[model samples]
Target: MRFATAEIDGAEVCGVIEEPFFHPFEDGVDLLEVLRSGELVAAGKRAVSRAGMPLDSVRLRAPLRPPTIRDFVAFEEHVEGVARAVSGTGVAPEWYAAPTFYFTNPYAIAGPFDEVARPPGCRVLDFELEVAAVVGRGGHDLGPERAPEHIAGYTILNDWSARDLQSAEMKVGLGPAKGKDFASTLGPSLVTADELEPYRDADGFLRLEMRVAVNGEVIGRDLLSNMGWPFEDLLAYASRGAEVRPGDVLGSGTCGNGGCLAELWGRPDRADPPALEPGDEVEMTVEGIGTLRNRVVEGAELPPVRPATARPRDRER
Candidate 1:
């Protein structure tokens, strides 16, 4: 069943979708709690039995406020392109050994149709097209074989990026920090994992078609089956020394090559899309789960931090 958390007439509402409409839960209901009950399908059916609100009527929001977000680089081709563009090298050997991920600020999430502002002093803006899994069941030290059950649903994720800041921070070797924490977009709706089972293969890969567009022009496309590591492995690895609780998100990084402009940089084979600007709209769609869209908006100016003064080692001694 498809579920959504949105605003209706200025109040928050969580609902189950029945195509053009969505059946609202009570005035106040927690989405994760509903998923954990293991009765989402039944409740959804019951909700659909009642008259519901039109999907176009309400404003969409991030499906849930995730407790943590682990975004993994799971596609080899994507990394091959990005690494070459940024560092003049091919995919790193270590990437093949295991699934690696970075944590982004979950609290900074934006809604499907929300406007994302270019961060202060940021001119090189980018967006990543990804699929994120929402944990329904909690677990620690989960094995890859046991991770599938933990996924409550799937949603389209846009890990909004500020390339200029990201590049500078990575050079310092610690963070994507202020570059990434600014905003990440999720939603349209949460699709229960069962809905995607038909696309899963014997190798456990999902053969869904993923595509992205900038202002209605399709710019990149790839198959979800191309990922080097699956969500199961990502979740398993994420749970290694920590607990993965309900509402935690695990992202299937940028799909194939061309998933983002950073990946296409200097690639003669692919046409470079213009940098994202205020008023530009980015839309990412994965077959089975619907499209997630966001608009770019001008950023608010921020006060600058004072730079540190250089110190001489001899003087300090």
Candidate 2:
């Protein structure tokens, strides 16, 4: 079942997307509530037929708010490419030994069809196509053997970045913060992990086709099988020395040769960077996860920046 959280008439409610129609759940709100109550299908069905409710009239919001954690993992090519961009040579060995990431504020998360404002100081805006796993159960020092137990489902993530800010911050060893903290887009819906369990092969690699488009132009494509470390390993590694909890989201980084500006555009000396300008629309899609669409607006008047508030979950051993 595809689950989501949305706002209808100023109230937030959980929901299930059934094609052109959306079935909104009750006041409990959020994917965690639906999963914990085992009422996904029942509540979804009721919302579709209830009085004063219009399945086609409500607006969709990020499927979850206050996600316990948000992890960016899964793309090896992106890691190598990004690392290369930073070092001007080869990747470090340590990046492979552990699953590393920066935390994002789930409260600031946006949804499909929302307008994403470019930050005031940013001149280069880029979009990344990724799949993130959602945590269903909380765990500490989780082993690879028990990784699957903690997974609840999956969804798409648009790791919007300001190339200028990210480049400057990385040099200081702590950043990409102001660049990334501005906004993050997630949703369409969460596809439960159970429904996708069959897609994993014997080698434990997931097989999903991904494609990304900017203003209706295709720019990136790859298979989930290409990820050097699968979601299970990421979960295991992330939980090693830390804690993980329900409603957390672990992103599959930018896919193979699939990120904007960072991978497709040529080097700094040869050509101009591929960056988003005002009015550019970005749409990202994964096989099971639905399409995530956002329009870009100028950042001439962005408000004072706020850092991500969610704390890090314990990493897996």
Candidate 3:
């Protein structure tokens, strides 16, 4: 079953996406409420059989405002390519030891069809093609074998990036902060895990096709099976020594081969696409999930950088 959060007649509600139409939950119900209720799949089906409106009549929002967002770098190819592009190095040995991830701002998420502002001073705005798992059940120190039970569903994720800002900060040894905090997109709909059971391989990896296109031009394509580490492994690592709550989101970072401009720029044989500019539209699609679309627009002007003040002690000396 697929679920979505939408606004209809000035009211926001969670609903079951029945193609062509949306079957909304009772008045005042939202996706987060449904997720925390732990009855999404069954409730969604019940809602679908009741009254609903045409899907085109409502505005979509990020499926839900995740309580926490943990995005992992689990694709070796993406890591290798990005490392080469930014620092002229190969994948760090440490990356293979364990899955690593960063907690991004959950408040800054955007919905499908929303217009995202190209961060001020950003020259190389890029998009990461990813798939995210939304946690349904909360847990701590979950083992890899049990982690799958906590996953509620899947959705397409676009970790929009400000490359210039990211480059400058990481050189100082601790960031990806302001550069990434600006915005991350998720949505179109949340597809329940059971719906994807058909695609699971013998090794338990989903063999789904993933693609990203910018303004009608196909820029990246990859298969979900290309991920070096599976979602269960990433989730298990994330739950270690910490609690993963309902509504927590775990992203399967950028996919392998060519999923973003940073990777494309590193490849000598492929011509890189121009950096994202105002009015650019980005669409990311995952096989069992759906397409998440966003338009880039100019952002508010940034404050001027302040100059450092002179030290009084040095002047006196």
lDDT per model vs. reference: 0.86, 0.76, 0.89
Candidate achieving higher TM-score, 1 or 2: 1
Off by over 4 Å in 2: 35-55, 266-273, 300-317
Q: Candidate 3 regions off by >4 Å?
A: 307-317
Instruction: Write model 1 residue lDDT over 1-317, tens digit each, in one string.
Output: 88888888787788887878878876687576677676667777777888998888888887788878999889888898878778888888999999989999988999988888899989999999999999988899999999998898899999988988898889988868888989989887899999999999888998899999999998789988898988888889999998888888999999875789888884757537877999999999999988888899999988875678897758653
Q: Candidate 3: lDDT over CA atoms?
A: 0.89
Q: Give one digit per residue, the lDDT tens place, for model 3 in 111-230.
A: 998999988778889999999999998889999999889998899899999999899878878768888999989898999899998998888888999999999899989998888777
* TM-scores of the models, in the order given: 0.94, 0.85, 0.95
The order by descending TM-score is 3, 1, 2
Total clashes in model 3, counting residue pairs 3 or more apart in sequence or in different chains: 0
lDDT of 1: 0.86
Best by lDDT: 3
lDDT (Cα, 0-100) at 127 in candidate 1: 90
Candidate 3, residue 61: the lDDT equals 87
Q: After best superposition, candidate 2 residue 90: deviation in angstroms?
A: 2.1
